[model samples]
Target: MTATHTYDVAVSWIGDRGTGTSGYRAYDRAHDVDAPGRPTIAGSADPAFRGDPARWNPEQLLVASVSQCHLLWYLHLCSAAGVVVTAYADAAVGTMVETADGGGHFTEVLLRPRVTVSEPGMVAAAVALHAAAHEKCFIANSVNFPVRHAPTVTAGA
Candidate 1:
């Protein structure tokens, strides 16, 4: 049997500078993402769309979500498979193409994960686990675009 999970968040616009979007360039593209007990995430559109460059954008958050999901599943699998992973980091990149009408969609995401394991003997299994982790990633399974991984495994002290 399959189990179901539900997530909830609240997004509120906090960018009306007393003008309330009277014009196209009137309001700032700022908002707050809140969950029950977590710190609020300040969000905006990508700076290319007249948003603050310093604030987190939806595009970045989406890419981060994919990266985090993959990493979590990879760790879980590594533990169960007896791969002693000492360190793990991923430099994930996503590409999005915009249409002539100012709409866009992500084309793909590449997850470059650098994993440090405790022994050289475990390298092969550690390297192979990335594919399994990708297969099991919840975010990757839900996305329309392809999510690919390039993993590097090294023995660590």
Candidate 2:
């Protein structure tokens, strides 16, 4: 059965600093991302846009969202395919190019997943499943840019 999924998040800007938007540099881009039962995420614009360096930015979150999607789907597929996973880690990267108008779009996102399986024989199957996971990832499919994976599997003792 096909089912629709939905998510809700509340973003409240808290950078008023007394005088709100008095000038370009007068207000900060600080904000908080919240959801029921979840801790607040301190968020801001990219540092290039005069945002706080300590806070999470939209670009980083976008990359993380797609990376998380791939990780979850890959684990499920591996389990179903009888490849026992012992460890999984990913260092996902995204590239975006800005236009003359100060707007930009993500050109692509690359997922580098390092996985360890219980048996040496499971390496090939584990590597192959990354393609299936990418194809099924909802976040990856929603983006206009391509989401690709370069997965490496190792046997863990």
Candidate 3:
């Protein structure tokens, strides 16, 4: 049997400075995320001395979401298959392009996963599990952007 879960992020526009520093808040189903004076966003400071904080940016979030999804599924699959995963990390990236509506949206995301396996021969199993995780990842399957996984695994380290 297949199982499913759901979540939501609600954002509200507090105000705007016309150029930037526009205020906004992201709320989970529970409540708004607490942060500093201004809601955290990626590229907060530009070279010209403007807010451009990239950590909280949508592009970053897209990459992070893909990374998280793959990691979650990897652990789940490994547990179910009796494979012990020692550690997992990913450097993910996303590309944004102008949409037909003259607004930019993330079009592609890449998940570069570096995974560690607890035993030899399990690397192969872990590699195979990467593909399975990609197939089963809910976020990857749910989003319109192209989500790709590039995995590298090491055994007994």
RMSD of each: 0.8, 0.8, 6.6
lDDT of 2 by residue, 1-157 (tens): 9998788999999999888999999999999999999999999999999999999999999999999999999999999999999999999999999999989999999999899999999999999999999889999889999888888899998
Q: Give the distance in Å from residue 113's predicted Cα in candidate 2 to where it truly belongs.
A: 0.8
TM-score each candidate. Answer: 0.98, 0.97, 0.71
Which lDDT tens digits does candidate 3 get at residues 39-92? 633233222223344224444566777889889989999999988999888988
Residue ranges of candidate 1 with Cα displaced over 4 Å: none
What are the per-residue Cα lDDT tens digits for candidate 1 across 101-144?
98989999999999999999999999999999999999999999
The runs of at least 3 residues in candidate 3 whose Cα sits more than 4 Å from the true structure, single-residue gaps closed, are: 1-8, 15-51, 99-101
Question: Which of 2 and 3 is ahead in TM-score?
Answer: 2
Which 10-residue window of candidate 2 scores lowest in summed lDDT?
Answer: 144-153
Worst 10 residues of 3 by lDDT: 24-33
Global local distance difference test of model 3 = 0.71
